[model samples]
Each structure stands twice: as C-alpha cells, then as structure tokens.
Target: MKAIEVRFAKEIDKSFVVFRETGKYFPCPWHYHPEYEFVLVTKSHGRRMVGDHIGYFDEGDLVLMGPNLPHVWVNDESFINGGAAYDADAIVIHFQENFLGKEFINIPEMETLKKILDLSRRGLVIQGSAREKIGKLMVKMMTMNGLQRLAALMSIFDLLSQSQELELLASPGYTPRQEDQLKGPTDRINEYIMLNFHREISLQEIAGVSNMAVTTFCNFFKNQYRCTFIEYLNQVRIGLACKLLANEQNKIVQVAYEVGFNNLGNFNRQFKKIKNMTPREYRKRLDTQLEEDSIFFNEAYIVNE
Candidate 1:
C-alpha cells in the first residue's frame, strides 16, 4: 500500500495571472493551494462544489476561494454530454500576505486590508455590489505590470475587506497545508474517473485510465484516497445527484441517469447508502435550504443578472 496524497494550488509562481481557455477541461480538483484565490467563472453552466458550499452556477458567477480549502469546478452533463464548448477566463492572485513586510499591513492605516486577507483563508465569495466592482478589478489586474500590479492587488483587498457582502466558503477548523496534497497516481485516477464515471464506468475502464491492471489499480486507489474505486465513484455520482435534487425542473429518474447511474434502482440504493436519505428526502432538504438561503439572498443581491 502507498501513502495518502493531497495537492495544494501552485498560485505562487507569480503574483497574478489571467487564464483564457476554450473547451478544454479544467479540474483543479479538491487540492488546496498556498495563495489566496480570487476567481470569477465567466462561463460554465455547472454546479460549483466549494468546500461544503454547493449551488447551481450559471455564467457570471463570482466567487473567492480562500487559501487551502478542498474545492473543484465540475462541468455538468451539458458540457460533458454535448461535448459543449465553454471558456474560463479568470484572474488569480497568489502571494504571501506579508511578503511585503510584517509592518506593511500591521500599520493602523492598513488594518482593513489585513483583516480581509485573514478572512480569506476560510474562503469566501465576493457578492453584492462588490461583486461587480471586484470583477472589474480582476479584469483590470491582467493589463497591469510591476508596481502597478501590486498596487491593484492592494486596492482589491482594501475594497473586499470593507465590504459586508461576502459569503464564507468553508467552516471553521478547516486547515489546508501544502504537503498533504502532493499525492501520486491517485490524483490521476480520480481525475480520469470524474470525467468518465458518469457512464457506467467499470473497473477495467478506471484501471485503463490509471494505466494499470485491475489488481494494481484497486490497491493504489484505496491506498491514496482511503476508499475503493467504486466507493469513490459512488461518492462522486451521489454528490452530483445531491446538487441535481435541488432543481425542480429535473426528475429523480432524470437525475439518476444524468449523474451516470444507468439504472434507477442502483441510483436509489447508492444514494441512500451514502446519504442515509432517499432522493425525495434530499429534495426536501434542498427546499429547506432554499428557504434558509433566502435570508442570505436578501442580504446580498448582486448576482441577479
């Protein structure tokens, strides 16, 4: 058996970068990174699984993922089934908070900016009017260089720190260190399974993806993720199904088929096994979430495009 592995984000190479991708798959995965991340998904009609915060994300979704939190952006059936094309153009800033100096943010004048970075570690989504303001700054940061770039980053944080319209992504007690993420072939296998697991993926299929034999892949998968391949697959499917259950437009059978379970019976059994609740119960919880979410919605009304 091999040891477990986790990978953190490598946003550290530079202070910031603007990425533009078309049709290419983006799966940064559940790994955390060293730097704080400010990202806006301009396109992708998929659900966002940030830490424990789950929700339907259409185009123009603005989110701020804090340092070292488990999260991923999954392409839904539309992109997966239609082989649909989409783009993810984002501005990511990765820096050691006091890379400048301990005295930089410690000054009374910089208290607000310092506070924002502290809150950022737990991850947060910039919302309300600030969402638009931040989005503009994100785009603007791309055209900057030298001291200009650093200045813009500081201004962005200054604005974000004072804004009351932000949502935290992860809960308390969530610590993301870098060393835990650099796992072996397990990440490759998980990535492969996520892309293909939606279509009645077999052990042979997953094994082939791993470029290993069934006997070897099984042991490796368990050793790295601490779960059998099937267990991991079921978790992925069930996780998607949980998101789908919130949509009133989709049916249970539709969700079952959509999430990659060809058979409805198996979907139900597996959903129950992992969630300890039936599909309807899941829907019920979603409805409750919607009601609860209305409170947050009232507080922040920015994403209403």
Candidate 2:
C-alpha cells in the first residue's frame, strides 16, 4: 500500500511518547514515521500489516517496529460496522533510535539492547510470558512520569532483549527504505505496485510510472529491492491472501483470484513457494490452532470460576 508519511507534533521537554490510544477503531491510515514504536493492543481484534507481512491481531498483540517501517492496524469488520459496543484501545510508545544518546548503544552494557533494536527493522512480536510481563510494565508506564517512565521503558527493552519468544514479521527479503528517500523513483514504483497489486499491473505500465524504459525499470527495481518486480508483487498478493484466508467463509480458489492470481495453479505454486505450504494446509492449520486456543481459554475460565 502507499503509506502516508506521518509527522508527530513533538511534546515539549519530552524525549519520548507513551500514551493510550482509544477510539471506535484505530483511525491511522497505512503510514510510516521516523520513530521506533512499541504497540500493545489492550482491547481490540484486527488485522495488522507490518512491512509486507499481513496477519491477524487480537488483544495482547504486542509488536516493536523500527523507524520508518510501514505499518497499520485495521479493526475487524464488527468493530468497524457494529454499533457503540466495540471500542479499540492500545498502549503506544514512540521513541527515536537515539533517544538515550547517540553513543549509548555502543557501550558494552547495551549490547543486547542494541541487538534487539537492529532486529526491530523487520518488526518483532513479543510472545509468551515476556509479552505478558512487558504489557503490564507498559500499562504501569501510563501513570508514571520523569525517571520512572524512562526506567519502565528500559525494563521493557531488557525483557525484549532477553526473550526467546519473539516472532519476526516481514520477509527476509523485505527492506524498508529510509524516510529521507521517500518519493524517489524506486519508492514511487513500490507504492504504485502496492496500491495496484490486487489488479493486473503490466510491466510497461509500472515502468511508465517510474519514467524509465521497461528494461531499465526492471534492472533498477531488482537492484534497489533485491527482488524481481514480479516476485515482490507476488509477495504482496500472498500477504493479502494470508489475511483473507483468516475468514473461514472465504474459499481457497476465491482467495486466489481475490489476491490477483490469474489461475489457481499459479496461486498454489506461489503460495507454496512463499508460505511453504498449500493454501488448504495453511487454512487447516489455522483452524486447528484457533480451536485449540478456544478450548484452552474455556478451560482456564472454568477453572477460575
């Protein structure tokens, strides 16, 4: 998608931002900003897009994204169209990579923090007990001020740096260009592809968007993105396909065409190549997992009762 550039109004005397965002639903568009973000979905169920990865998110969804990584959280259909009962809420933290100091991360004591920050370029989803602990700290940080708030943030970072339960979003091949380089030809070309990937996009048409010859555009795209134009396009389509498949009502073949694949065979081939499984297998696994979660939740509730 063509992400809007978002600029936050700096709060005077504050080196970082930590606040609760509540609404009928998250109103942010697909966007990027020049700050690393820590987000914990406290009350919501939705689809989260990070870089080129698409997946479902629910309450307790926690992710850390590096500066300039494009992302957005879209509420589920019920939250968007349902009446007043549904409310989306999250604890959000935004900080510059150098918030502590330019040389802070270079010190021996900060090695793990530095490593986690580097890994955040692909975005990291905190999982298991680490997520629970960090979520509590973030909630506590809401009421804190001054040194305490900063201390809480460092604690969260400490937890993240040591946690093995971290899942990386975005593909290994996906790279986010720096914000200063936005609107350049390659960026424009990428935006165009993201916006039109659901429909037919011709090589000549995309090259025209870049004002380059077809051959030149192809070479330029490969050099800049480290992937062929078609490969990147399929990556986007497959990402969307993963989201659509979350709704069990959507048929597999229907999803293929919906994601812009011209034929079922080609969709299957690409899906397997990117996802390492057939669509059918992917859906089945998702269903099984959901069932297990539901069972676990119910059992815990009964025991508590």
Q: 182-268, model 2: which lDDT tens digit per residue? A: 457966786676546767899999999999999999999899889999998998899789868978999999999978899999999
Per-model lDDT: 0.67, 0.83
Q: Which pairs of residues collide in candidate 1?
A: 6-180, 6-181, 6-182, 7-181, 8-32, 9-32, 9-33, 66-123
Q: State candidate 1's TM-score.
A: 0.64
Give every collision pair in model 2: none
| Model 2 misplaced stretches (Cα beyond 4 Å) | 178-305
Candidate 2 yields a Cα-based lDDT of 0.83
Q: In model 1, how large is the Cα lDDT of residue 140?
A: 76
TM-score of 2: 0.66
| Clashes in predicted model 1 | 8
State residue 195's C-alpha deviation in candidate 2, in Å: 10
Error of 1 at 133 (Å): 3.2
